[model samples]
Target: MTLTKQHLVNTFEGARNNNSPYVFVGIEAEGIKEVISIPSVSFDAKEQFYNNAYSNKLVHVMNSKVKIIGLTHGYPEALTDLV
Candidate 1:
């Protein structure tokens, strides 16, 4: 589906109301929209998933216009190979 700025706005609002932890909105240069949901889970699980998504070569090859947003419990100042 093609998503405009308004769609993202609406999605964010809905996610906020639903208490969603992560909402990834991917948009292609051509305007195709892809939404990925990452619910609140253990830190390790979330990190693993995010690491996989971040390292997925297919995503980078598919499109360069990708936007990633994440909401967590607290901001931690730690960086690892998987994270």
Candidate 2:
């Protein structure tokens, strides 16, 4: 599902509160539609990662406006369908 900023914030908070590992995959809201990964973590860290415009472990997009399209919990089973 597409997520707005507030939705993103809430999702991040929920993940953190539950101490669950989640990996979100999104595309740019505008041109190029670059793909990116939003790893579950603190809001500050997510903001930092967004601002930095880079993902060492995943694809990077400059000034990315992430629109989450999918997510998976951190576990082999959770990734089976995705893979």
Candidate 3:
């Protein structure tokens, strides 16, 4: 099920703060649409996964209707978009 608009904010908060391999931005037509501003995978200080795609694993959680704003990939060209 799609999360309510408010839940989108919560989900985004978690993702933005995450220091994991990848962050999932929750889009509910939300309040601020934040990108991961914190330190990432030792490449750049502000290289967020915004407007991109992730592994097929993410497809499980993202489903079809969900709109992705970022992705982390082994092959950068593999992803359709990158933000």
Candidate 4:
């Protein structure tokens, strides 16, 4: 099933609250839709990539329009699930 941005935000928030590892992976909304991954911890960086702004740092740089396609707890799971 195709996931929405709200789903991504919700998953991110839930993981944060539970203190569990999370890695959000998705592709660009347009063009070739290159795959990219964003670790939950990155949100806590000084850049504040996870700011309330819809056009946050990760989206602005990694993908103009990121469509979260998969979520996993840590790299091992990401590798197994996303692959």
Candidate 5:
């Protein structure tokens, strides 16, 4: 199964709040995807995806103390260039 925008948002939100830097991402089987923490990098949900998939959810995300840059789909190295 393909990961939906909502799934990515939820995963990002959870990882963001806990100050996590990385999280494993997969489809269909929840157990297949492991949540891993990545190093912290300055990120903003509104600025990144305001006009994209997160526009409607911007207000809720703004309340989060931690910054969310992007959702992880693979190993930590794959996310290094994203930050």
Candidate 6:
């Protein structure tokens, strides 16, 4: 469902409480949604590839059935490593 600001906040809070490294949250106008969280792990060369692949996959899913409206991040390291 049209991802509202509250959805973003809740998603971010959930991930933050769980100590997640990255999270992708998608929603549709009809209220269908999905939330994927990347676990905390050692950073390596493959990290970039994993991030890009998963992010693309998230976008693809969102584009296919829903509209991505916001991004709320909990991990700061994602700012440096994950795009």
Best by TM-score: 4
lDDT (Cα, tens digit) per residue for candidate 6, span 1-83: 44444554465566667777765533334566544344445323223433343333234332444445445445654443223
lDDT of each: 0.40, 0.48, 0.36, 0.51, 0.43, 0.46
**Residue 4 in model 4: shift from native, Å?**
0.9
Error of 6 at 62 (Å): 20
Ranked by TM-score, top first: 4, 2, 5, 1, 6, 3
Report the Cα lDDT for candidate 4. 0.51
In model 4, the worst 10-residue window by lDDT is 46-55
Please write out the lDDT profile of model 5 over residues 1-83, one tens digit for every residue.
Answer: 33345655665666677766555432112223233343345334332453252324222243432222345633466555345
Name model 6 segments beyond 4 Å from true. Answer: 25-83
Descending-lDDT candidate ranking: 4, 2, 6, 5, 1, 3
lDDT tens digits, residue span 1-83, model 3 = 43333333343444455534443343322333333323235323222232133223222244444443443332323233334
Candidate 1: residue 20 lDDT (0-100)? 58
The most accurate candidate by lDDT is 4
Poorest 10 consecutive residues by lDDT, candidate 1? 73-82
What TM-score, over all chains together, does every model reach?
0.34, 0.43, 0.24, 0.48, 0.34, 0.32
Error of 6 at 1 (Å): 3.2
lDDT of candidate model 3 versus the reference: 0.36
Global local distance difference test of model 6: 0.46
Instruction: Please tell me which model should have the higher TM-score, number 1 or number 2.
Output: 2
Error of 2 at 40 (Å): 4.5
Write candidate 1's Cα lDDT for 1-83 as tens digits: 33334444454556556665654443233455443444445434644444454423323333455533322221122112113
Error of 6 at 52 (Å): 24
Candidate 4 per-residue C-alpha lDDT over 1-79 given as tens digits, one digit per residue, 9 for 90 to 100: 6554555566566657766565555445664544455555674551244334324233544456654345444544555
Give stretches of model 2 more than 4 Å off: 28-35, 38-43, 48-83
Residue 81 local lDDT, model 6:
27
